[model samples]
Target: NTDVTDQRSAEEQSRYLMGELNHRTKNLLAVVQAIARNTARSTMPEAFLDTFAARLGGLAASNDLLVAQDWSSVHLEDLVMGQLRTIGADEDVRVVVGGAPFLVCPQHAQVIGMALHELATNSLKHGALAHPEGRLRIVWTGASSANWKLEWDESLPSALVPPERKGFGHVVMVDMVERALDGVVKLEFRSSGVLWSLNVRGPGVGR
Candidate 1:
């Protein structure tokens, strides 16, 4: 009788552990599903779900990269390039990146990654990357106040201003910059191109 009771207790413990794991897994899936739903609902129904999924996946990839580095900051240049590749943009896609290596906190890195992804997706859909003759220039510099400024300028020949209706991508970009990073975003519509400026502050340079 004693042996049977011990075996039952062990089995119960194993079952309890498995149940707890399953519950946690379900909760995680629920969170991901909520994200997908929110993304879809925020944009027009015609917006591509695949694109939304891809952006979320990009965030996951960035998270993994940061994890590999033990949650330390990442180089701005490398992080930008990695996010670009996540969305299937080739290095030869008229995309120019220039900046001295600078470190950004993990939280900053994630926000920057999302912002970059949003901008790249917009370019691919309607801004610069839509046309073969178009070009994108990304530049970054550090300010004396320990702030950082990154700019995205695109020269799309004959390109028109973005539509009056702001999409989910735009909303996400603005919110991430303002709320997440406490940064400012300036968007300009020019006859020759579109220019975006992002100003952010973090730990001092070389920290």
Candidate 2:
């Protein structure tokens, strides 16, 4: 009788895990589909595969942190450092990250993670990371129990010509962030480089 009871409990746990796996699998696939669609739309046919792969890699990096933390939440510092580490800039003196850490929900984590990745990738490809005299600074502060803010500033040696159009990364930063955090996003490509900030208010900042 005891053996039978143990078997039943084991089966129940297995079923629960199976259900969780299914749910996460579906969620990941949905994100990938969205990424694919958007990447295809924004990239030239010849450049699509590489672009999609890099974006997917960014998503995977976020997922890795989530998985390590049992999918409940991710620390803001971890998210920022993980993304920067991908491009070998984590140890660069020119790149400075100073901020108050926050526990971000999975939904916000995904968007912010990708946004950070895109930002770092851009720097590596075209911004300060590409030049010796450039500097990049990232700072975040909690305004109160109900709000927080993040500021990203990149300084290049010379003025950057703003893109003529908004591309996939640009859209991801402004649109995805606003939707995820119930926040206001201000992004601009100033003469020096890029300046982007987000101020998130209400209970959503912590949640």
Return the top candidate by lDDT: 2
- The residue-by-residue lDDT of candidate 2 on 123-205, one tens digit each, is 88888899999999999987456668888899999988788889989988989899878799999899899988988877575
Scanning candidate 1 in windows of ten residues, the lowest lDDT window is 198-207
Count backbone clashes in candidate 1: 0
Which segments of candidate 1 are over 4 A away from where they belong?
A: 1-34, 44-48, 143-145, 201-207
lDDT of 2: 0.88
TM per prediction: 0.76, 0.94
TM-score of 2: 0.94
Clash list (residue pairs), candidate 1: none
Candidate 1: C-alpha RMSD to true structure equals 6.5
**Residue-wise lDDT of candidate 1 within 7-108, one digit each (tens)?**
999999999988966874685466467557768777666765776677787777667777677668777777788877876774755989998777777766
lDDT agreement with native, every candidate: 0.75, 0.88
Q: What would you estimate as the lDDT of candidate 1? A: 0.75
By summed lDDT, which 10 consecutive residues of candidate 2 come out lowest?
A: 198-207
